[model samples]
Target: MIERDPLAPSRWSAEYRTGEFDEPFPWKPVLGVLGIVLVIVFAHLELQSKRIDELHTAINARLGGELEPLRGRFTARLSTLRAWLELREIDGPKMRAADLDFETIRSGGLLSVRRKRSAPGGGSSIELDSDEFGECLGVPSTSIARIQRRLAEFTPELRDEIDRTDHFLTLRGMQDQLDRRIDALLPELSLAIEARFLLLSEEDAEARELMLLLVDLESGQEKLRMRVPYEGRLLTARVMLDETTRAKSPGSIALPTELPKGASDCAAASTLREAIDGRHSIGEPMPEGGEHAAE
Candidate 1:
């Protein structure tokens, strides 16, 4: 390093210096300015973040207020729809049952009038097996008592279904109780055999059912009590069966020497060559024509 005199006189306006910093750089002023700039930038960023959060909160609040009523209405509508579906579910089986009952009622008259055999009074009726019920003619109370005794073996609920007038049932006592298949009563409610037994009644609805016969569709098994007679011309057979179906079906009577052609249920048709001179119980066999009763 060169030393210069402190009192020397300056002669030029421009001075050229070949010397630079001989000690460490001065850093305090630069650091102070940089710190001020950093503080300003950080404060600006913090303010922007706070404003952005407040804007988001305001937007969310406005949207929630607008949608609250819509949400409530939607919830109520959904609840109403669910309730309606539930009600329909509850009524579906009932409606189906009612429809089936209506159909049964509509065809009930035709069903009752379906006569495979003719009655003495020319009304609708069925003819029973002769050997089983030939003695039921001219005496009804005995047969009725016997049938009632058999019916006693059944539950009162099932006995209540035997209401149709002239509805017939041939009880075999071989099938299980009627209540056992009672659940299938509706689905299998059909009549195919009316020539065996007769269930007599006076009224339709308020009438008491004294007899019932049910035949299973799948098993061909019978489910009722008692047997009956099926035979004879309207003229002779009806005389023997007086007051059974309807009061007296005979007119200008003849004892019926020979049953009408193709007619076989005539009580007088016995090969014994005589009219009804003796009374025989349905359980007894006649001395004529090998006429035996069925169990």
Candidate 2:
């Protein structure tokens, strides 16, 4: 290259600069980033799918094999509790009609675990059956659940009954701690309970064994809840339904059905108000299978 000053045309007060040249874009880095983003998105979706499947499996297991049956057992126990208190019917399918009797009106599910309390101070523990563990965990688990607590919140009568039952148990069980005047009433209550047994009708006895059963833990739940009517207030409930001669009446609700198979979830007693909602102007259609309970 030679430096030479040759024939220059001069322009006044203008600076010289070069223009920008066009070049191919940097596609590789951009494509790598896009591919990484797609991979991340796909990975997130796969993780979500796996979580959903696990949830479904857990729910099914809870419903079918382990949890639900224990819940049903515990519900049946409430009926047992009711009988112990000398309240009304136990509609375990077998108790259906034939008596839609006065007991039927007081009808519902009850469960009992009958093993003499070893006289309060005796260190005797009842040997639990394999299913007993299921019952223990299931009741309290569902007891505080949203559906059940809502049921309690909705029914003041139920809350009252629970309080009443607890009160009765407290008074009766702790007679020594009671005031003198209230203690005197216990004898009269016993007499009243005895009279109820004598007054119980034959037909009423046939359905859910209108009396409470007194037995040991070895007797098993099947024996405790057996539909054998008794003379005094006894724990007798139909564990299995004799569906053959079952008479159909909406008023005569079945144990397993009306309860949506969950009694702690429903009610022992329903008044005229509960049976029908009068607030609604028009009648609504009935659902299939009838009285389907909350899941």
Candidate 3:
């Protein structure tokens, strides 16, 4: 109510008391700042998403470019190897069975008999025959004598035993003893043969399983190769891929690149010589260009 001095500080005016100095909370400036912040955040997120997409594309391209060719080469070589293994499997069983049969006979399945023979000079020599050695001794005496000579070379101990025995009855007893000895040896012989058969069977099975796995891998690679864009350098890449797949062996396929770790387990590096010649000396190598030989 008192008059105010001009130089003195003035008391609050009616406008100030009514909030006229507040400036409506500056909502436009605040909204503008918020918009700028949102734009910056969205821009950063967009950049991150774009980078992620680029990385994904790069990874996929690398996989298609590199892994697919390797897979193709591996498959081709594996197919060749599997073919060879199949051939071995086909011819192996009959030969092994025949050998086992011979082993059974050699282990003592034949009888041994000796008879006195009169030579052309009127001096007598010893002759031999048995159920296993010669045919029934009477019908064709010449055939019997030839068989006896062959048996002499094969079973000298049996011949000696027969010759030492005085009487035919004693020789018969010795034959029975040989039969019993054979029966006693059969179980062990059969066990050995079975063990060998199982070993070979297991080896063949492992090779087959590895071949199947390679087939699956090859199928997957083929699909991936199809997906790869055929444009640009990829066309040349495909040509090179074809060349790689045409390789006959792992050494040729992995050339200029180290073999994958599991390659040895697949037997991919095994030589053609090893497959053809084999480790065993059981039979002669199949002649080259033979119909049965794998190409």
Candidate 4:
């Protein structure tokens, strides 16, 4: 027999050696995936915490830095209104007392921040209501926005207040109380006046004459009272404008029909007596010149 070569390939051994079992890697790829997932989870948590802290800081800055000055302004406006009312009370007596108490008229939601997460592609924005802004500045909702325009000069400050917004909701209980007071006053004033007039005037021959005289006197008083509010409003506007910009220009509004051109010695006697009882009235055009003269 020929000597067998150890290195010679044999058909049976080659067929058997074609496939072999692979050795397992010492470090599992599954463990590497698990570690990667853990790192992602930790990073997400840290980012969320940092965002929360940023939001908290923003709120504090708005509350302490911005809202405090706004509160002071509101209080000052209320005080000014009160002073105006007091001046009128001192000057005119027929008009009922005006004690619009600010303590009772509670204000809420000065500087509240609302955050809404964005939609898929949209960015977040804030909205502010005019009524809410008015309340923040201690102005009536019916205010003609003069204050708004004036305050707009302080743009950065106003924008900050507008952005860090909060809902200003009045208490239902307080609103109900206010509603009741308004309701009681609305229908009663005219009725009370008619009743009082009837009680004062006799139902006989002198009744008509006495009623006419009383009407005349009341009309004069009404004119006087109207002047008080007009003058007070003008003065208030002037003061507010001065406070805002140190402006010294006299804001000349159109003179009404109550102020006459000439002077009269008697208290109720009108210089334009003919006009007062006739078509043309006091402070109205005296035939030719326009209502407002050139500067």
Candidate 5:
């Protein structure tokens, strides 16, 4: 047999060589691995960018839409409160009696009571005929209570608005100031995960404290608004008395009698000014009127 040539060309020679493999395209494995990693990283960054945009959009919706409307409602209720306080001269007993007289004639109570003036003042004139004055006094008080109830609805709405704003701004500031960069450029997935956890932990604590304070504010404002009508009706009634007498008799006691000691002492006075000073810890006497009344 002819001696086999060791390096001789054969059909199976290229396939059989095994010592040190080399390819015509030697860099393909390294390039393929790098391309796969690049694709994955770019896709992850795209998704994160989309999520950050979504967060910003969510923030705008809550701050502008919900918060603004609730604030407007609070403003409107405040205006109503001022109007209620200013309406100090609401009609008293005589005016209400006149209104009732017109209604009674229309409804035919006139047919029942004969108008008996005691033959040219033989005794002290019956001041109000008693029963009619009681009915008349309820008018201004009822009107004031109606205004109070409208204000009552604001307490909860305002609280909710404040809590919502607190939550949104806290989250928004965190995302804007801290998270945007780290989430985008970091190579390792674990680092981004750790950062997100830390940020959320801090935000949660702040939100809880803010919510509690908002609740307390809501309760306090509600109490103040409620007392206004209770005290306001009394003051309005007194002012009405002064106006009625002024209309008929000309000179009389001023609408506010000189406050004895000006409610300056802590002693009990039934009037609105005294009540406000006691409640608000204001020792200085409010001048002659309702809460906003000029001194």
Candidate 6:
């Protein structure tokens, strides 16, 4: 081999030229691209965050301004309806008792009396006075009239049923017939009550749905909690009405197989057959031997 000159450039001189060091490292171009990508990602994220904040603000404003007021009105109406239902339940028994007392007085059975005494010789003597029999059965006419007026306040169907009951019949058959009519009417009354409740519940459901849409906006949990009591009242009223409508036994009444097509239009007929066969006490028991009559 020929001797190599130490000062001469080698075959790999092009690959390791001084120009590579004179220029900047290749990392600068990669770093610039990376910085540009980071800026784009940050800007995209900020835009999305701002849009979400704006949506939330709109939802909050609507909930506070319009939806909240509407919800309050629904709540108040539902509360009033619940109270009225409770009053009707309590008054039912009182009205029935008044009817029974009035029937007892009008029938003349309450007025029949028989007195027995030991005779001077040995045998017992019997004395019958029809007029003086139930002197104690003097239930105030005002009381009976008051009950009649209250019964009229119920739905037209129920008021019509009370009107059809024969007031001139004797006490013996009058009480039984009146009771039968009442038992038959119970189911209709229950259905009427249920119809009203269902209407109210539908309105309440709409309000609740609107509230759910606003959950992410603000006070969502608290608003939902506030609805619980109103919902409970509605459920309770429905349960009681359903129970009355489905009863199969005599004392417990039920609707006919063919129910009225329109819940609000179920009017009482001129005559109602014996729907329930068993005897049922509507209110507090009369005193022993009818000594004390209903007030």
Window of ten residues with lowest summed lDDT in model 5: 195-204
TM-score attained by model 3: 0.28
Candidate 3 lowest-lDDT run of ten: 221-230
TM-score of 5: 0.26
> lDDT of candidate 3?
0.31
lDDT of 6 by residue, 1-295 (tens): 2445566675655455444334445788899999999999999788766655554444344434543454445345435433322221111121121122233233322111112223432133422211111222232111111222333443456334433533323322433454454444343333222221110011133332100000001111100101111111111112233376675433443434432212111111000000011133223433323321111
Best model per lDDT:
3
User: lDDT for each of the candidates?
Assistant: 0.29, 0.30, 0.31, 0.29, 0.29, 0.28
Give the per-residue lDDT digits (tens) of candidate 5, residues 1-295: 2334557664545455543333345478989999999999999888766765666666445445544454455446434334222322211111011111122222221100001124332233211111111122111111222223433433556435433543444555654643443222222222211211100000012222100000011111111111111111111122223565555343433454333321311121122222222433323332222222111
Looking at model 5, residue 224 earns an lDDT score of: 14
Off by over 4 Å in 5: 1-25, 83-295
Evaluated against the true structure, the overall lDDT of model 1 is: 0.29
Best by TM-score: 3
Q: 3 or 5, which is superior by lDDT?
A: 3
- All-Cα superposition RMSD per candidate: 34.2, 23.8, 35.3, 23.3, 26.9, 29.3
- Compute the lDDT of residue 188 as modeled in candidate 1: 18
**TM of each candidate vs. truth:** 0.21, 0.26, 0.28, 0.27, 0.26, 0.26
Which tens-of-lDDT digit does each residue in 82-165 have in candidate 2? 333232322223211111123322222112222222233323432211112113322211111222232233244632443344
- Mark the regions of model 1 whose C-alpha exceeds 4 Å error after superposition: 1-29, 87-295
Which residue pairs clash in candidate 5? none
- In angstroms, the error of model 4 at 283 is 6.6
* Candidate 5 Cα RMSD after full superposition onto the native fold (Å): 26.9
* Clash count, candidate 2: 17
List of clashing residue pairs for candidate 6 = 107-170, 107-171
Worst 10 residues of 1 by lDDT: 89-98
How many residue pairs in model 4 have overlapping backbones?
1
